[model samples]
Target chain A: MLSIQNLHVQVEEKEILKGINLEVKPGELHVIMGRNGTGKSTLANVLAGRDKYTVPQGNITFNNESLLDKTPEDRACSGLFLSFQYPVAIPGVNNMYFLKAAVNAIRKSRGQDEMDAIDFLAMVREKLKEVALDESFIHRPVNDGFSGGEKKRNEILQMITLEPQLSILDETDSGLDIDALKIVAQGVNDYRSPERSFILITHYQRILNYMQPDFVHVLMNGKLVKSGTMELANELEEKGYSWIEKELTAAD
Target chain B: MENEIIKKSIAEEYKYGFETKVAQDTFPPGLDEGVIRALSDIKGEPEWLLEWRLKAYHHWLNMKEPTWAKVHYPPIDYQSISYYSAPKKKTLNSLDEVDPEILDTYNKLGIPLDEQKMLAGVAVDAVFDSVSVATTFKDTLKKAGVIFCSFSEAVKDHPELVQKYLGSVVPYTDNFYATLNSAVFSDGSFVYIPKGVRCPMELSTYFRINAANTGQFERTLIVADEGSHVSYLEGCTAPMRDENQLHAAVVELVALGNAEIKYSTVQNWYPGDKEGKGGIYNFVTKRGACRGDKSKISWTQVETGSAITWKYPSCILQGNDSVGEFYSVALTNNFQQADTGTKMIHLGKNTKSTIISKGISAGKGQQTYRGEVKIMKSAENSRNFSQCDSILIGDECGAHTFPYIDVRNSTAQMEHEATTSNIGEDQLFYCNQRGISTEDAVSLIVNGFCKEVFKELPMEFAVEAQKLMEVSLEGAVG
Candidate 1:
């Protein structure tokens, strides 16, 4: 469903991602683990069509179409979702209203009619249950005054509500507690289907204990150095990323 | 690329810019005692009113236009602006006798003059240029002991009420522009709710400036008697002109014991072109007086147009336990500049006031929120709470706040909060990633920022205000 070929990205005239290549098929889950400043979040943002990052080399394709010229909204309407590392706090916009706008905008782009308020509310309530958020959240401003765990759970709630074809979860589990992490993973697991895929970008391996992944890759210096199964995640958890850096140095 | 889009959006044309073609009785461009006398004579005013106009005219000659506001414009050529311009229709006993061109103009502005086609609960008084052309639901209002008519009609038919309440809140000698407005003010609306009677419907006045090179000076006075209630609304718009047209209006409101008066305004005058060539110079004075114990007054305004807007609708809480409230949403785009807020003067014991102001600046627009809350020594145990917030859309725009607070009574409690923020790229990207367009995102964020003030508006006006915000911030994303 998604392909990235030797993608090179830069921000503020400094290269952040150099010659990174990745591929994911339908229904597959890919976990990219890296330390700080290793371009894990950069790859997720570049895929979501954030304009601040410039792509100077190679290409990225989604559903067999080049995504370089598509706007962020266009990319979103084409079934791409990015769970931001830090959710923005829109002070007075109700979460329900914002979600309805998003849902209707995507539905309109797909040549479908808008979802009525009644039906949308019903769907949102059900999705809230999956993320363990109560009805009070719908009335509050979008992410304003939300705790770290609540924000992560809200991202997962959005992922469930949008039902995107490919979702990039950028550090969604970084600040979550054990209970919140399980709830977020449960929401993701319940929403997974044969035609949906996810790229979970995180700095910890704790969340992997709740949800299984098809592939685990270690990202270092903007490149995917190693790719393996869940056992590699367990190995990295037992020994931190420093061992991987030592291995890369010995290989060089 | 983003800057180009922002420029394109801010360049959106003013929608209410079409002129009305009508034969007008316009005075030649000049301002003097003779012109004021001629204006009063043309209106067939009583001798006392004419003398009052002369008094205000003499006072205006001594007063200089104040320039402390954070706005820049060339000096106004007061001598070059015609003081009076009205459609040449002499007398109108009914809507049938009104000029079709004037009626067509109002109809095109979405205000149907015919009673049956108007909004269900809104009684409208349509003022064209310098005269009140038509007033609807007069008989219905009269049956409820409510006197709703033009200022001139009130002067002729209900002179006692007019003389009692006119200038009671904001006198003719209030300020420079107000003094000028009093001298040659042509026509506006007057509403009076009798003692213990609640107004049955919404009272609204629509002011339209159609004539070229003419200044529009209208006076509006509303009085809510003891135990009465009323909701009044004012709307204004002007045709596009090459030279800046002047609009100086004065509105005074009075609420007696247990009376509640709600005043709302949606000001959408022509805000000039992209380069700010021509538009309305709106300098208005609006004030309300709580004259008896337990009286309440609220001022809600949504201002989105005019090349330069200088207004501060104020309230004087003179009655013990009286309440005053001000809610405003001012949006400035293109080259528009607005310096507006409200003032609350607490003069009675246990009086309270609340102010919520929201300002949005886009393009090269500049906006300021200047508010004042004063608690006098006599206002023992008074309280005031104020919140002022501003949001800037583009890099070139500016937002400023100047809040003046003076509390002489130690028992008084005052709270003030202010914030300034930009529509950051991250917020826009977050909305875009959710499948919403940048334009829609801008509207959403701005409407959210203005939610507090918009909630204070009437339902219909609230919806119109939201749509106006969307139009004003059309492509303001950066």
Candidate 2:
């Protein structure tokens, strides 16, 4: 469903992602693990079409179409979703209202009939239960004064509602407690289907226990240094990233 | 050659020059006591009203235009423009008899003047140029001990009330524009809520400037007696014109002890074109006074129009424990300029006031926040809180803040906070990464910046203000 060939990205004139190549087929769960400032989030941002990052030397294709030329919203309409590390607080915009606008925007781009408020509300109610969020959350301003756990759960809620073909979860488990992590993982697990794919980016290996990944890629200093199966997550968790750093330095 | 320069300057006045073809009754351009007398005579006003206009005219002549505001403009040629112009229509005794052309004009301006449908619960006093065209829901309002009508009609029917409150809070010499408004001011709305009476519905007035070579001068007065409460709304829009038309209006509100008055203004006058051609010069003076203990007054405004807008709706807390508030969202795009804020004067014991201002400047527009908070010695234990935020969309635009805080009473507590920031590429990218467009992201961030003020508006108006923000910030994002 997604392919990145030699992706080299720069933000503010500083190269953040260098020579990244990855591929994910439908129904595949790929996990990217890295230390802080190792370009894990940068790859997610590039895939989501953030404008601040310049793809200096790379081509990204989603479902056989070049993704670099599309806007973020266009990418979303093409079924690409990003779960932000820190959700934005859009004050004065009701959560339900924003969700409706997002849904309508994407639906309009796809030439589908828009969902009315009543139907949209009914649709979101079922998704909210999957995330265990209260109905009152729909009436409040989006993420305004929301707790950290609530923000992460709200991100998952959006991922569920949009039902994107490819979902990128960037640091979704960073601030979550044990309960929140399980709930977030449950939300992600429920949406796993043969036609959909996910790229989970995280700093820890604990989230992999809840929703196992088909492939685990270790990123270091803007490049992927290692790729393996779910066992690689446990290996790294036991030995830590210093071993990876040593391996890279020795190879250099 | 000087005539060419003057004509160029005059053409530059109106930024929006979209005209609506309609016939109007306009007097020859000039201002004097004779002009004022002719205005009263044309309306068939009572002799007392004629005397009152003459008095105000004499006082206005002796007063000078104020220059204290942080605004600079060419000197107004008050004597060179007509002050009174009303569309030539049959004297309609009812809404059904109103002229279709005038009704079409209002419809074009988004004001459905139909009495039975569009304006069902809304009591509308439609002011076209210099005259009141129609007032709906008067009978309904009268049944609730509320009086809503045009200022001219108030002068005739409720002469005693008009005589008692006219110039009470904002006298003729209050300021430059107020002085000019006092002299040869055509017409506006006047509302009165009887003592202990709560108005049933919102009272609204739509003002439109339709005549060419004429400056619109309207005066609005709203008084809520003791234990009474009322919410009043005013909106203004002008047809596209090439010449910068002058709009100098004066609005005064009086709230007696235990009364509350909420005044809101949505000003969408014709802002000049992209290059800053002709537009409305909206210079207005609005003030409210809390005259009794425990009274309250609030002002909320959404200003998205005008080539140059200069206004500061203020409040004076005179009664013990009285409260005052001002919430505003001002946007200036293209070549538009706006210098607006509010003043709160605490004169009573335990008085309180709050001011929240949000300013958005896009393109080459200039937006400023000028406000003042004064706590007198008599205002023991008074409190004040002020928050001002400015967001700039482009590098060429400018945002300024000038806050004056005066606290004479050591026991009074006052806090002021201000922030100025541009829409950073990082924030935009962040929203974009979340699948929101750049325009929607800008609107979201701007709305967040104005959330502190938007929450102060009533429920329905809060929604309206958000939509207004979206409209004002159109095409502002890359």
Candidate 3:
């Protein structure tokens, strides 16, 4: 349901992503393992249509529709969700208000009727259970003053609320304790459906214990250098990224 | 795309920009002894009251315009401004006698001048230009022994109370603007809550400036008698104009023994144009005096307009064990400028005060929060706390804080905290990536920033304040 081809992205006159290619089919969870500065986060941001990240050459398509031309909000309305690694604190906007605006915006784009406050609250309360959030959490400002784990769980709650067609988790596993990782992973597993797809961008394979992925890819030096099955994640966990670096050097 | 959005936002016009067509009889231009005497005569003031105006006029002449505020504006020509303009229609003894055209003005302003149709709990006194056109729900107020009417009407009907308390809190010569307002002030509302009687409803005054080239100087006074309580609301809005108009107002409050007064304001005067062509230069003085033991006074304001706003609503806690509170949310967008805050003067023993102020600046707007807390030698054991926060939406805008504290008594306690934050690009990107537009994101951030002060406003005004904030930042971010 998501495709990226020849993705060359730069930030601040420095190339961060060099000719990367990725593809994910419906109901598939593709884990992209990479070290810091390897452009995995840049790929997620570019896919979510963030500015200041220049895509010099490449094309991304979601559900067979071009995503390169859409604004960040438009891309989100098109069912592309990116769970930020660091959820920015929006001090005044309540989490519930933010979600309602997002939900209505997406619904408007999709020509669906807006949800009433009662229904919205009911739905949000139901989803909060999956992420272990309480009722008060929705009324608080978006991620303001939240702990790292709470932010990740809040992001997961948003994912559950929005129910996007293509979800990209940008190192959401970081800063999360083991318990939080499991809850977050449980949220993702609960949200999974045959019509939805996921791009799990992470550095470690610890979270893989909670939710299994269909494929694994290693990103290094701004490109995907290796592809394999779940066994690759175990191998990388045991051998470390140095093995992939040695293999790349040998191939070069 | 960014520039296109900026241009569109810069072109954003005032929503309350429409002028009402009415036949107006304006006083001759220029401020002099004759002008003050004529205004006094029009109100049929007592000889002593007229003498007070003359004294204020002389004091105003000697006082120079205060340029110390963190705002920039051209020198005001006092003589070029016409002091008064009133609807030519005869004074209405009742709602039926009120001219339909005049009622139409307030109607378009979302304020139904018809008393019976007004919000059940609010008694609105509609002030149009130089006159108080209508004061609604008088019968209900009268039943509660509350005297609510125009300042001019009070001069004729309740002369004793008006004379006893006029300028008692904020003297005529208190400051430059207060002196000018005292000299030729038009009509504003006067409210009196009798001893031991809580006001039956929220007393509100809606001030509108309709006449051109005429300055609107309204005087409001509210006295809460012993053991009484009252909440007062004042809202101001002006039509869009190319030539800058002037608004200098004086508001005074006196709370007697065990009494409490809560005064709120939502000032939305036209903030000129994007290039700062035309708007109101708002210079206002508002103060409350806790005159008796255990008295209390609180002021909450939402200011989001005016080309230049220079106002400080202060409280003088003069009674033993008195309390004072100030909560404000001041926003400036486009070419608007505002330097607004509060002053808490502790004069009585064991008095206490709290101040919370929020300032938001967007586009080319400049905002400043100037506050003061003073503890006198007599006010031993007095306590005070002040918090000032500012949020800037764009880099081109500015936010500033100036806080002054003076304590003569070693036993007094005072605390101050200030913080500055910006609606960063990352924050907006985060919201946008989640399906919210930039405009909605700005509003959310700003509303969150002002949530503390907004909770202090009355429910209806709080909703309107949020909407006003959103409207002010229409073109602020892209």
- The best candidate in terms of lDDT: 1
| Tens-place lDDT digits, model 2, residues B1-478 | 1122122321123322345566788999998878888898988888876776777778877778777655566787887899899878754368876677878777766665787665447788999889888998878888998999989889878989988998899987677678878877888999999999999988899998888889999999999999999989888888776678899999989999999999988888988777787789999999999999999999999998898999999999999999999999999887889999999999999999999999998877898899999999999999999999898886778999999999999999989998888776666665665567777887888887887777777676678778877876676665
Which residue pairs in candidate 1 collide?
Answer: none
CA shift at B231, candidate 3, in angstroms?
0.9
Error of 2 at A3 (Å): 1.4
Instruction: Give the poorly placed runs of model 1, Cα more than 4 Å off.
Output: B1-10
Q: How does residue A110 of candidate 3 score in lDDT?
A: 90
Residue A60 miss distance in model 1 (angstroms): 0.6
TM-score of chain A of each: 0.98, 0.98, 0.98
Candidates, ranked, lDDT = 1, 3, 2
Better of 1 and 3 by lDDT: 1
lDDT of each: 0.91, 0.86, 0.90
**Best by the DockQ measure:** 1
What is the DockQ for all candidates, taken in turn?
0.81, 0.29, 0.77
For each candidate, C-alpha RMSD in Å? 1.1, 5.0, 1.4
Of the true interface contacts, each candidate retains a share of 0.83, 0.42, 0.92
lDDT of 1 at A199: 96
lDDT string, candidate 3, B1-478, tens digits: 3434455565466888888888898997899999888889877889988999999999988999897999887788889999999988877588787778878888888885787677657999989998998888899999999999999999889999999999999999899999999899988989999999989888999999988999999999999999999999888899999999999999999999999999999999998998888999999999999999999999999998899999999999999999999999998888889999999999999999999999988778899899999999999899999999998876778999999999999999888999998778888888898888898888888888899999988898899899988888887887
Clashes of 1: 0
